[model samples]
Target: MLLKDKIIVVIGGEGLLGKAIVNGILHEGGVPISADIKPIKDSNNDIDYIMVDITSKKSINDCIEIVYKKYGKIDALVNTAYPRNKNYGRNFLEVEFEDFCENLNIHLGGYFLTSQQFIKFFLKQGFGNIINFSSIYGVIAPSFEIYAETTMTMPVEYAAIKSAIIHLTRYMAKFLKGKNIRVNCISPGGIMDKQPINFIKNYNSLCLNKGMLDKDDIIGTVIFLLGDISKYINGQNIIVDDGYSL
Candidate 1:
């Protein structure tokens, strides 16, 4: 049991990757509390689900209060929330400046707000851990050629937000030095969500092994960082892109 008896709160716990992390934490004996924008029916009696909007300070603070009240002490925080504006995912040329700012404000801004509140709590608690999610594109240039005939294109705003997350991890780790607080980032390649066949073909060609990873593939890293084994591992970006960034 890597995380036995620990209380781990996963923001965006209703998402694709967040769900896997929740299940993985349970498998390793940790108590997981799901914080998402919308409520999800509890399929498992072990999980404590709560409605949270990462974009709002009141919402985030309330979530922390609720989790702390129930769990007593929070051991780690896992952020997978990717809030976006309605006009998110537009092509570069079509993306307006306002839309770009809004996307970053929600996604990256939310991460900052939530982390800030948690870090404050952690400071008083004497220890804490934060795992932020980035993307492989944050580390390398976009493989635009892959989208050749597909209707999909990597949103420019996505790169800005994700890349900022990577550096933010480093900044937080350094800023929180000697506080027993840890901050780290994970950069995963294209996860195996349904996509155009041609795009998949192109993506696979650039990868070393698997073309795209599943949500479960990231759980091991999350478990490690949350557990004591990664006590010294902080301020680093762990890439799980199947070598796609290489």
Candidate 2:
């Protein structure tokens, strides 16, 4: 087992990606902790589950303490929490200040604070892995105004914040080098979820023009990063976009 007996934390654990990661960790024999603002349906008394608001410093610190209290040390932290901004649709102009800030806050501030709390433990123990979520959109510009058949579309702040997160992962990886802590990112393509009508219409058009991806496409990358095979692969952003950017 790659992560046998290791304690891992998956932030945004209530979401689809988070739940998938949690299950993967469990399958690998690692103790996966589900950390989120909302409790998941699978959250039980035996397994570790924490309530944390990534945007709040106090809440993050408290959750860190809870993790430390439950498990002696934290082996890894995978942040997959993202801002809820689909309500803006394709209208980039309608994306408000609060919405933008909220998205950026979790992608940037959340990673900084959460890593800050855990790095202390990692530094002391001399072993930790931080896996952040980036997006293929971070690497390639979104088709804001690409003329398909006859329409235009976009996803604004999400791509912006995800790009910022890639840099943050690099910074953390370089800063924690030789301390036995590693930082990396997973930049996945659009997940196959039942998105809103506007998003679906736009995405389908984009897919027809470009291509689409399935959720399972990310599984191999997730396993590789979480396992011991990637011990030396630090401070890198791996893009699993199925040539969406190509």
Candidate 3:
């Protein structure tokens, strides 16, 4: 019960990683409010989610108001929404300038909007926590060889967006100096998402152990951040990649 009774909002609670994080929070005795455009399965309807479009300022503000009124105080905000256009995920060479910009605006811009809106709420409450998602790709360049026989290619837009998030976390943390608000990021290694066998094999070979992380593997880090154990750990990017980046 490390997070006993804490009211934490998971921004992308409907997504793969987001759902896992929410479950982990519940296991630790935290009350997690799912804030996503798509509601989680069933989601208890009324109390399950705070439906939101993170890209829209009004939607985010509404989400804040709803959660605050219901939960009284929001302890932490974990952002994992992966909003992107259909043109996204193209290879670097095939990525048009317009497509790249649009994806960035949708994904990265949404992150900015959510963080800004939440910080305003946190300020009024006197304390808050913000945990953002980055990736191994954000910390280091993609390994193109892993995708040789697969259709999977790292998108340029993803790199730019994730890397930018790292800096934005730091900027927000410093900007809120002595304000009792903490900002941090988690840069995870590749998770086991049923990708091509060749890619998985190549990726595993790079890691020291556990070639690819399970969703549960990342949960501990997030839980740690949400608890008082990491009170002093602010504006830092914790990489949970099993030495994959090494």
Candidate 4:
């Protein structure tokens, strides 16, 4: 029970990775409040659930207010909320301005807005933890084909936005060090349930992939970053790829 009674706010809790992080928090005896745009599953009733739109400032503000009113304190924040756009995979020449801005809003603006509001709360309380999400793209830039390979990836927009997030995490960590607020990112490898048959075929030919990818592979890194065990770790992008980026 490392987290024993800590209140954790999970953005995008309705999604696959988000849900896994929430479950891991629960397993460690932490109380989780899921904030997502969609209705959370009924099984999550045992924990707290709030419908939130990360793209809107008012929506995020209102959600945080509700959490503060109920939980009295927000100990941790895991920002997993992001947008999906078809225009993300196009070549540099084909990418549209609107699509790129939308992607930036979700990954970059969303982090700033959420952290801005939460930092205020954390400042008042004197302690907080923030675990943001980035991708392998932040380190090793992947191609548009790699973006199209799984739902997790996209070329210019996602990589650009997430790369910005890695820097944002470091900046926040330094600025908030005196206040005891910690910020870090997790760069997951390829996480997928079912790859397109064509993607698997191409991957096998070029990558020598032996087996299908699983969603559970992303869990452990998340657990470590969220717990007190990582107290000394800050402003770092911890990559959990199975040598895919090697």
Write one digit per residue (lDDT tens) for candidate 1, span 10-93.
Answer: 998999999999999999999999889967955677788989998899988898899889878899999999888888887899
Residue pairs whose backbone atoms clash in candidate 2: none
Candidate 4: worst-modelled 10 consecutive residues by lDDT: 204-213
Tell how far residue 121 is off in model 2, in angstroms.
2.7
Task: Please give the RMSD to the true structure for each candidate, in Å.
Answer: 0.9, 3.4, 1.2, 2.8
- For candidate 4, write residues 169-224 as lDDT tens digits: 99999998678899999887666657677666544443335433456667777778
| Residue 186 lDDT, candidate 4, scale 0-100 | 88
> Looking at model 2, which ten-residue stretch has the lowest summed lDDT?
145-154
In model 1, residue pairs whose N, Cα or C atoms come closer than 3 Å (at least 3 residues apart or on different chains), thus clashing, are none
Question: What would you estimate as the lDDT of candidate 3?
Answer: 0.91
Score each candidate by Cα lDDT. 0.91, 0.78, 0.91, 0.79
Q: Please give each candidate's TM-score.
A: 0.98, 0.85, 0.97, 0.88
Q: With candidate 1 superimposed using the best TM-score fit, by how many Å does residue 229's alpha carbon deviate from the native?
A: 0.1
Task: Give candidate 4 regions above 4 Å deviation.
Answer: 143-153, 201-213
- Sort by TM-score, best first: 1, 3, 4, 2
Q: Which stretches of candidate 1 lie over 4 Å from their true place?
A: none
Q: Indicate the residue-level lDDT of 221 in model 4.
A: 77
| Model 2, span 27-100: residue lDDT tens | 77889888998866864554678888887878877887788788888888888887464453345777777877
